[model samples]
Target: MVLKYCLLLFTTLQFIQARKVVDLTHTYDKDVPKYPLGWLGLENFTYFKMDTLAAQFIDEMWIAFKKIEYYEHQGTHIDAPIHFGSGRQTLEEIPPERLIGPGVVIDIRNKVTNNSDYAVTVQDILDHEDEYERIPPNAIVSLNSGWAQKYPNANLIFGTENTSDPTTFHFPGWSVEACEMLLQERQVSVLGVDTPSTDPAQPPIYPCHIYLQTNNVPLLEYIANLDSIPPRGTTIVLGAPKVRGGTGGPTRIFALIDDDQEQEITSNSASRNFMSAIFAFMYLNVFRFC
Candidate 1:
């Protein structure tokens, strides 16, 4: 009976674990900067509206979500193919299959601090091939340039400090070369970062965005707390966020890690399917028991 209880508990825990979610968004505030070339402005944000005891009864007032309407480009956003081209997926077409993948992190803070225009290169991806090998295709390749820590100083963080150079944008970006390395070579479906844009903060060289999205790739910008995810062996989840015909909706994201004593997570779909079924059964049983 004790052995059976242990199995039941173990199965229950493993099953419910598949759905752990993480928030990969950065809050929009006054400090976020607009590129000199970009024309965007926030029109409505939250201003204290009237409170009333109406909806539920029992002295029920609400501090509601009266949002300031602005372009999706203002905050942490996923760019649709239509953002750059006409007649493209309006954020709704992003395939779930492509949206989630093995999360890859390349910490380029040191190099980026020295040279703000640093482009993520082929060699950089090569160095982390071992990590990438573990993640499935269509995974999110996140570039960590330590840029988010500079959020307080939006100007300096964007690399607009005393450089007097146009490429003074402080962090690294996916080079068109690196984009190919990620997409064509690695076959990644999405590219992500913690900075304002996926491309380096420069003009006449938006190649990274063009290259990635031209192939229907997506971008996740303004991510934080990636330090929590393991370097490998974790399944990242983008829970189904319901936004109607929305080109892109803000996502809640996180990592699902599996520690197997015998086998490692790989490209074997059959194995993954089996594991997923086991977890699903466990979760259903737990819910039933509860």
Candidate 2:
């Protein structure tokens, strides 16, 4: 009986651990792509720097620490509503509920293969909805342009060797119409992209940024590994820093995927129930032996 209980508990633990977590964030460092400050006349300016502050023995133990500095929006980061809007939620002010939701990825890699400035259109959203079910309310809708392959490469990612020139850069992003539909119709909680910005590299005006931010929807940019998760089933969790008054900051995003479709065991309630059943069985077995 004891062996049987141990085996059952081990099986239950394995089932609970079967869910896979896919990281959707890029590693932050000086090498990560950043907006060019040359347009603002700050040529050759470094936005990120890390230096070893301490590397010595402390209380018979070796200790080391590094001092790091970077722009709030650098690397895989969240752009809080205040990034573009005048009086919107700051980084720390964003509600925790808004940072987590179902994930939906709209792939536009084919369209973006040749045209660097391609924008995800409203029709794309409609087509995605037609294929998958209607996007759930508070979904984190992400645009997958296959741009994450060019990560840490300033020239290839931006479509220009002159990284300092914004006008010369090119990339794919979300269109205003698509963003509007997601905001107004589907009531999405967050917008995400695998590119550096939510807007195309060379837009006349940052329409998506302005409109979405004004409406108080946070944006996730420079996201990585969109190819790893499914379009609609996974749940997205954004690990954004609670920086007071910050416009934006680096974020660690993850997608939790249920590999076993038949079992449908990824839901929190179901997992709790399954664990409870295992515990109940063990308790009943112990009482019988007692």
Candidate 3:
């Protein structure tokens, strides 16, 4: 009986591990969204063939190339301590372990809907602390606060629009205290948010940036579709940007692990977002060290 029970348990765990992976990344088009006050969009780019390539197309088609000028911070990206720190590691210097890890998603969409700028507090983290021990130390902490509705129109992604209507714009950011909690107390590897930034859009630029950097933590912004991940348990893989000394670069994000399809799709709107992310980018990559 004991042997039989152990075999059954192992089989169940294996079944759970066999679940599929979902891509939670948004395809960056010429009109990738931005914040209500921010100015960002695709740039002028062209693909042309050089001497031999042009000659090949007209004559041959060999020396061909594509070129454009754009910001490294465009699209889904990650923020490094150097983003806010005077002297810190750049994108290239960032380790793959630091970029990717177990991902933890926290659902606060309802709270955010009530107040666009509603800051995530320590209570918010503690409110769901029942699963705190499960959140690994080097994991990527993601906060799902449902700030994507405002970006239905690509114009808002640039953060520039008429403010006459109250629903014109909204952003969910982390509070200074909450930032301290994740940085100083929790000591997470990285803090990710499914919004324009990790801090509230107010008089200050990035409170989370200041605190996290001071505390040796990093931040990832413009992450969408966190609603689909479980409040905990899902492993997060961070795809670091290939920028040299840049402060921040876009990211292709996702959540991996077993999440009840019923709650993720029908019952839990937040989990739906994470599922959406998994659907977007199917090719999930593990870390590579040279």
Candidate 4:
């Protein structure tokens, strides 16, 4: 009886340990969409790739090598506080522990579909909290505007007829009040969005960027597949290049769902423990009665 109980417990724990990971990053290539104005408000990104397989095919091994280059801020990337200006933490300065946390997806797809320049307001955050508990401390809040489906077309993604003037573009972003509430009041670790930036494209002043940058809160931009993440109860893991003294760089972000959340392993720990107790009781009762 004891041996059987032990095996059952082990199996139950192993089953519960299985987790579901969802890729929330967009692939970067020559055709990847860019932030129209680019880093310095100049031309778009420059990505180059060279395959040297034929050139180095002398030996029987036939080794192949590829060289690639692109801007750190381009594609799905994180914007370090230093990107704004001096006296801030660089990409490397951010602690590795802050890169991962509970994920919260505040969906604004309805508002965005109606108004392209709609900004996520403080009331929206409050409404979300009222519906689904409060945003936990140090959680990573992601703004899902359903913009990931509009990729490959730079014009449509940025909502601009021309790329010369960035001010003409339109997209949903976090308002300054919302940023302050999340940063100062709620104390969230990271702000991620499906849009190209954290602030509205036509804002006279990028208050959202200033609020986050000054507070040392990392900003994730151009994130993809946010629709896959639940409003809560998901863990996010971020992987990015550690560039020394760098302002920002591309990042690979994903979310993890536990067995209970994914409904993969229905047998919980408590259930298994109760079963073990019942088995032991039955075994003892049978022997005593016999």
> What C-alpha lDDT, on a 0 to 100 scale, does residue 38 get in candidate 1?
29
lDDT of 4 by residue, 1-290 (tens): 76676667556655545466789988877777665455456764465354454445565666666666776677788988887746888988988878999999999999987798888999999999999999999999999999889875788887887755677788888998899989888889999899888887776357888878887888999999887767888899989668898888889998887656655334446654655676577557643443
Give the TM-score of each candidate.
0.70, 0.85, 0.69, 0.81
- How much RMSD separates candidate 2 from the native structure? 5.4
Give one digit per residue, the lDDT tens place, for model 1 in 2-51: 55775777776566544334455566554454444323353344322234
Indicate which candidate wins on lDDT: 2
> By TM-score, who's the top model here?
2
Tens digits of per-residue lDDT, candidate 2, 1-290, equal 77687777667676665567889989988788778776567766658999999999988999999998878887899999999999999999999999999999999999997899999999998898899979999999999999999998989888898877788889999899999999999999999999988999876358999999999999999999998777878889999999999999999999888655313533346655676686678668753553
Residue-wise C-alpha lDDT for candidate 3, range 139-231, written one tens digit per residue: 788787765544436445423365322244456778888777776666688987767677765543676788686555667776766665566
Model 2: pairs clashing at backbone N, Cα or C within 3 Å: none
Clashing pairs in 4: none
Q: Residue 82 CA error for candidate 1 (Å)?
A: 1.3
- Each candidate: what lDDT? 0.63, 0.87, 0.64, 0.80
Shift in Å, residue 15, candidate 4: 7.1
Candidate 2 stretches with Cα past 4 Å from truth are: 1-15, 41-45, 261-290
- Candidate 4 residues lying further than 4 Å off, grouped into runs, are 1-17, 38-41, 44-62, 264-290
Residue 254 of model 1, lDDT score: 65
